[model samples]
Target: MPGMPKPIRLLSSQLVDQIAAGEVVERPASVAKELIENSLDAGARRIEIDLEQGGVKLLRIRDDGHGIPVEELALALARHATSKIGGLADLEAVASLGFRGEALPSIASVSRLTLTSRAAGAERAWQVRVDGEGRVGEPQPAAHPTGTTVEVRDLFFNVPARRKFLRTEKTELGHLEQVVQRMALVRPDVALRLTHAGRGLLDLPAAADPPGIERRLEALLGAAFLEHALRLDAAAVGLRLHGWLVRPAFSRSQADRQFFFVNGRAVRDRLVTHAVRQAFQDVLHQARHPAYLLYLELPAGLVDVNVHPAKHEVRFREGRQVHDFIFRTLQRRLAEGGLAGTEAEPGAPSPTIDQRPLVGGAPPPAGTPRQAAMPLRLGDERAGYRFSFAAQRPPAARADAAPPPVAEESTAEGGALPPLGLAIGQLSGIYVLAQAEDGLVIVDMHAAHERIGYERLKAAWAAGRVTSQPLLVPVVVAVSAAEVALVETHQALLQGLGLAVDPLGRDRVAVRAIPALLQGADAERLLRDLLADLAVHGDAGRIAAEIDRVLATLACHRAVRAHHRLGLEEMNALLRDMERTARADQCNHGRPTWVRLTQQDLDRLFSRGR
Candidate 1:
């Protein structure tokens, strides 16, 4: 018995592929993601999916896009074979969403996979079938349209371990629905039809604009989300962030609603999650999470696609900038009149510009206090839709000794005003006015200063210039095996931030100095935070970033806040420095530094011709 041939021989290449499929194909949702991506890559404008019993039974996907040629049918089932990547260099800048050539083989290994494709120029179609044993059958002639049709059935029949782990039918179907919803958001131009157990579940046609996309989302996710959603669009910085952020009132108890994508690929990234939470820190309760569908676009090379096995996490070359941009852009948009709803009121007619005077006459002098002469009243009857003051044009300029550092403009009176900058002018004791070259600016003295201080601290850390104060008493931190590895790799960078540490034992470190910015902090909490960051970001580059992020937060707490009064020179100096900084239009965390209102913008508010 001892000399008998070993029963546990090395797994054959085919078996190894099937084993790898265990990680990639968890359930019906996994197959859906890969198959739908194939349809999208084929340039399909219309896609229809039919599934039965959460795809445990028959699953069929039909598309009307340019399909594969007859000759390529057999090669399509081969392992590690794909048109997405060519040579080794393709791995470095993976552009397509489905680059790993494992999807087809993995799916085929678990289910009885059948592929039927017909290229546009070809006269005939071809079909290929792969049984559960990685055996390829002979290709046969088939009758089909000029597109591909993939059918998968009896998933996990060969792999009992996988099939046993599947959840209830309803739960699995819910997960599948989530996959479809995300894909629809990514490709709004494609018409997607989904059917479950012969019952139609979702039918989304191509949308004309972002609003149409939102409407489709409302139909799928719920109309309540749309009521609380805000749209964000910023085209500069070689990136675009367009999606909806739920209002504070509609915050969810769970974070499952926070969806983010890069170049149409959905990802669950901690950097993005942390940034969003930071933006909503003040508004939402600790247990609540803001729901958002943020789409980011940039050159593929700028992002690293090899971060996760599931392809749900990406590393950007400038992740800090991207994170900052998204957080700030959304927060600013939310702050400025709540993103001006595009959906009109149920019955009210749009106002015609026949009586109301046009705004934007002349720039008001800096320091000249002003308010809206006539605020546009909404339809709420209790507020009484009536003008509060006699509208008049503001004079262009006025002479004063020091030139008012703050400025305000009334659009109802035909005055152009820029968005309020960080700098403040003392008005009525609390109100701060901001001055621009062409218009007036107004701001909340307290909130603006707090945000400014927070940004200054963030900038210092990003530049690797955080000042560390030496600790008179050293603290010791004890951790586990993985945490010790993290501490050792990040020792140098941590020291640079004023944390003096030394290995105490196999799984412990003695902290000699702490970040001066975080003086008198809880040593235990700091150590725990360091370990947590290391666990999530398990690479050299991410570790360094984590160190800087920790230092930035500490410095922010020590910086100045807005409510603190400042002299004339101080306000002027702050504005001057802000303008000179790189990305001065936005803060370190990606929020805008200011918003401007021009004369014509005011005229549009009133029923006036400019």
Candidate 2:
């Protein structure tokens, strides 16, 4: 009898509400998120939040949205009571941010809460109070504006275990600020103000115009992000995605700056992340994450937002279609940014180069086996500065070999200068300096050449020009029956990628041939990885990525290296090639290939105005 378990019994309402609180409220940040979402759903254009002790002691939120009538003040604090949805059909196509209606009761169960509101046509405001014991008091007359105000005090005060789990005041406040930031990003049309212990922390006005949006971005994400970011506005197949994507050069070390919202609700979806990562595969470093603030607008019925209690994730009805759309749109936009003489997006102003002095040196003495410093000067005495450097010339081009022929359009003297301009000289045998119509262009020869080569190789591969080499001995791999079926079904697709495989038995496949570029790769391992990718993504992206990786390696090896001296004609040819290549702005390794310094930048460097 002592070891026997207690009889089964129904849990009390207070206990059930507290249990629900565990899922809805993780900390102060969670509370803020839920409350703010409710305010947004109520059509509040301006909301104010005041926190004390990182919202553990007090959280007061005021919103000028449609308020609840006096009759519903008590019902508003009841679990599962909400105006957002009515029945199962409404739940299936939820449009509001807060539909579960558990937030108020769950939060009130953990702390003392006061709710005050005045309906649209109400003559007076009504107030209701709920204690930690889940006791709802009768409504009483109160003084308030024509909206609603929710005040939560002593969070987790009744639950010592949850209270002790809270982090430091500063740490909790930081989390709260991030929640506010996310809200501000998603609802740029809503005004938001946050305060901590009577001190203003964030104040963002509604941004309705382009300039206002840019200013808001600069204030929230910093001037550097706004300067380096590209505008994106793309729509297809009943879906619309618009936002800013930072260039590769401005990629973040962490994913802190990545924000994706679905129907105005911020979420972390695997399908979206995978698509974005694949889009940046060729131009971004593996260790870095692309920074973007993208908002996706689709019909509410097309996505299920009830997957999670916090609604931090969503499941699309057509997952594959959504993934492909996001990938193609971003990839095309990035490629367009590489075009010559064009900014990332049309009508978007080009970013001004930071003011900085250019420092370089003359070549070392001819036939000097050992390197030594040498000084060179540019401009008049007032604007000139001495430069020094030492290095050995790279192999490839001879000093007296004739320069390659240039196109007539490129070399025409009377015509306008090309986007990259005319090559002036080689600097330190590593950079190519050019004179442009409006400024100076400095190109990293090695990096630029690598990108050009990679793009060409990709083009050739895409055109079915990549040859296949039969393996000396067919490599057989044992896999699942499902994988075997997959291999046989996708054989045609595989053959197009220069991969030839035949099913040997129910669970075995033999790889007969592979791409010529991947001749020495481990055939069995490669096939396994390819199969895994196809099974997951249902596409040839895996094989394509593999081929691209090998092609990138070959390009990097054959590209011009540092310390390579080039004739003016050769430099000009290279620049023209860069102008014609896709994704030429960055090398295969995600490094910038060139930079522009306008005449204004030069003036600033020389203190001309001062």
Candidate 3:
């Protein structure tokens, strides 16, 4: 039996196509992404997408780009055939959105497909038909304008198992719509139209200028994002990043609004994601996601686009440099914006310590300068719904230190002032009530101080280097074969994070050391998470970011908490710092720390305007 030979056979063309289809056509939206990418690559200025039964029954994409010629119509359905790339040099850069020729054949293998195209200046249009069995029909003259239309019907008609995996119409439609949204976001200059079940779902007009682009954004991401968004544009080290991110005040509970593109291609790169997270970590409220639409562009030779069949993922040759660039740029933008509800930017340095008995990070537990926080009730009868001030007294700080840095903005003369105005007095033990030129300013004392402390921790961590500790007993962990391979290759990455990992078994690794700071942390879980992050980032600098979060925890514990009484000067000092500090509008958890009500706003509240 050992000597018996098994005959090797080539798979049928249909089966080969079906196998490739499995990778390219995972769902209805997968088909949509490929076809739409093809349209975009064709230089389509106007594209129409129509779906029926969530694109399971039908998917018709029409584009006004340069249409395919009649001669290439049949070749378009052939496997491994594409006009995008002609040689090795062309494949290296791959500027077009669609290059690999698997989309048409893969889609045709699982569904009924018809491609009709009329090239520019052609007298008549031509069409080619392909069956689910990969059979190609002869081209025929068709009535059409100078454009192309790809109509896919009854997806997975020959594969019941794949069809069975299809979800409800609404769910599938949601996925399809997301693909369209990503496309729409990047190509603001292209007019897009989407129809579902015979009714128009989305119609985006082409916008060529900044204001027009903003109008398009408002139509898609909602007015709140537009109102709060801070525009960011910068370039460095052969890379350019520009886009808009809503302030932390407008962040959503889920990462629904985040969109990042590289070279006009939408990607879910972990390096970019980690950079954004790091930039906004201190100011972003925990468990909330930022809202943004950003673009990063670099030379094509520096990145590989052929790593994945669908091209959703890309590999960067200079992952570390790219990661740092994005992190630093976004962090600076968020800081300068001063109110990063969701717009990304790094934060000022602040010490985040571990204060378990109180908050996450604060000063020394018992013997530090104590500033009792104050709060104002929303609807209290006494003091006209405001907390009564009891002889203002500043919080006690170390006698050795100078009072919080101050640049005077207000005096007894009562003149117009800055946005935060001048600190007037304390309210309750949780809020700082200040008088602005227009009306009143309500400050969440705990929130504001927490942001201040968190920024300081970030600064401290960024300025210093990570110190890793060697483990007395190396911890071995189970892993996939790929992970083992990854561990072997990215040993330097681990070393940088102060971790020493060596492959143990075929699918396991031994952790001989860890970041000195991450000691007593779940070595197994942390390693796995780090491995996962590495898998996504491909060594996009995770150690510094992980340490920053550790600092965030420290800052949370050390920041001032609610119920601590603060004096008039302490309140004013906090206000001044906030005005100067980056991302002062939100706390570490990404919630707004203060709000301003102008005199007009106050008058409207009481009907005084009438």
Candidate 4:
């Protein structure tokens, strides 16, 4: 008797529905999401939601969409009955928000559901009722407009286990409000209203233009986010991405402000998250998350949205392509804007720099500010004091040569001034103060120089100018079979990053050469870290990031120290270089290099505005 096996049996239809409900209907918020998506799929332009007791007791949704006919009212409550798709081919390319058809039957199995609808040209409305026992009632005559209204009461009434899991009224309401907010953000052309316990919570009108969308964003995400956000619209191949990205300075400690939508459906994808993190890694502080509202659109056939019952995750056919595209687009945008472009105050004019060469050129046409000749040397042995701008300045100039004379440009009449203005003086031998057209500019000399040097080094490394240093004896390191395979597969990529690694055996690798710039570093540790990154992301970004980190450290040490004294000419040269460098707003360690104090801010500080 103890060794006997139990007989196999098929679950009842009602029990099967309830089991499916466990996946699709997790809570009241889940119910709201399904119903709202259904309304949108029905081409509803105006929808209203009413809830009581956080939707555990009563939940009602009314939509001005073409509803079902009386003859189909009974079938709508049946299992596997859907008008959204027909065959397997339609399943592969599902464009609608919902198509599984399980939402109604599954929901009906766990609660009381009433469906009322009136066709476009029907003489009257029809209503059908279903309970948690899977019993359906016949369609009956009802008084209603030319639309549909779904009323669900006593959620999980029969399934006490599931009902017990529901949280308090306030917590459930919060989750439900988030669902409504996500829906409202995606469809700017749809008007949505939400009321809880007879109290109006939200009313969003349809937005028709860009300005209207901006107003909606402000209302939803707050004015501060919109103020520091950059509008992005990029398209390539068959994929299109558009959204707003907040600058790194305004990043949040938590990821609650990020919203990503794919083909009008809110989803969470690891590929997308990795790409965003890679793009902002160099600029954001540790543990800080970038805030964004990004929308990605591609052909539905290229993505599989049917993998999950909740439809909150999707699988991309070409995940690597998507990742690279996202990373490149954001990286280019950040570089092109530089510091002045994104860090300007909301109402302040963006500072512009003079396009004239800053080093070794003919004199300017009469009245402009004279460009200083300050060359920095950053060779391997010169990690103490001497910095090099050899990449920027002409090769003929020496590192220790004195800079040329500075001809002060008059701002009183008609002279042009760069965006960062002219360096007025130094503060504590650390900060370089400058006077601009609208206000004052403060620059941290050490941080600013570190960023400038780091960018140049990265450019040099990317251009294949960084040579590799061969070890006297190859360093052998033990690793897993997967790590060895990674090394073999990415041999060429590793070579490009100045890391020469080859599989020594089934579970080991030999590192023969490292980046000449990082000659004395630990090759074994670096290779292990790189293998870990490759195992996770399946890309060369980790190796590159590792090299960049070492390069950043070198630049930080070689950069001018805080206590170093400099004349106005030297400070002005540093300021001009910052204007041309990418990501100059923050140093390699994600600290701001400069800040601006507007005249209004100064007036407020002095109580003059009062």
TM-score versus the correct structure, for each prediction = 0.63, 0.87, 0.77, 0.84
Q: Kindly give the number of clashing pairs for every candidate.
A: 12, 0, 53, 6
Name the candidate, 2 or 4, with the larger TM-score value: 2
> 1-610, model 3: which lDDT tens digit per residue?
4897979999999999999999999998999999999999888999999999999999999999889999999999999999999999999988999898999999999999999999998989999999778889999999998889999999999999999999999999999999999999899889999999889999999987766776787688765555556667778999998887666655677898899998999888766787898777666766878878889999999888898888888988898899889889887767755322222244311111111111221222332211111121112122211222344333565432323323344433334354465676556567787776556777888888877787777676557776778888989899999999888888876777778889998988998888887678777877888778778766534455567677667777887877676666677678766766676767767777776665665666677848
Model 2 poorest 10 in a row by lDDT: 371-380
lDDT of 1 by residue, 445-557 (tens): 34344445555655566676656666667677778877777788887767666666677778787777766656676765676676686566432333334454554355345
lDDT by candidate, in order shown: 0.65, 0.80, 0.76, 0.79
Q: What's the CA error at residue 493 for candidate 3, in Å?
A: 11
Question: In lDDT terms, how accurate is model 3?
Answer: 0.76
Ranking of predictions according to lDDT: 2, 4, 3, 1
Query: Between the candidate structures 1 and 2, which one is better when assessed by TM-score?
Result: 2
lDDT, candidate 4, 1-610, per-residue tens? 4987989999999999999999999999999999999999988999999999999999999998988899998888888899999999999999999999999899999999999999889999999999679999988999999889999999999999999999999999999999999998899889999999999999889987766777777677766566556656778989988787766655777898889999999999988998998988777776888888889999999889998999999999888898888888787655544343333334322223221211222322322221111122112122122222222223453433323224444242245445666766677778888777656777889999998999888887787765899999999999999888888888888888788888877988899999887788889988888887788778867667767787788889889998676766688789778877887766876666776665665666677846
Global fold similarity of model 3 (TM-score): 0.77
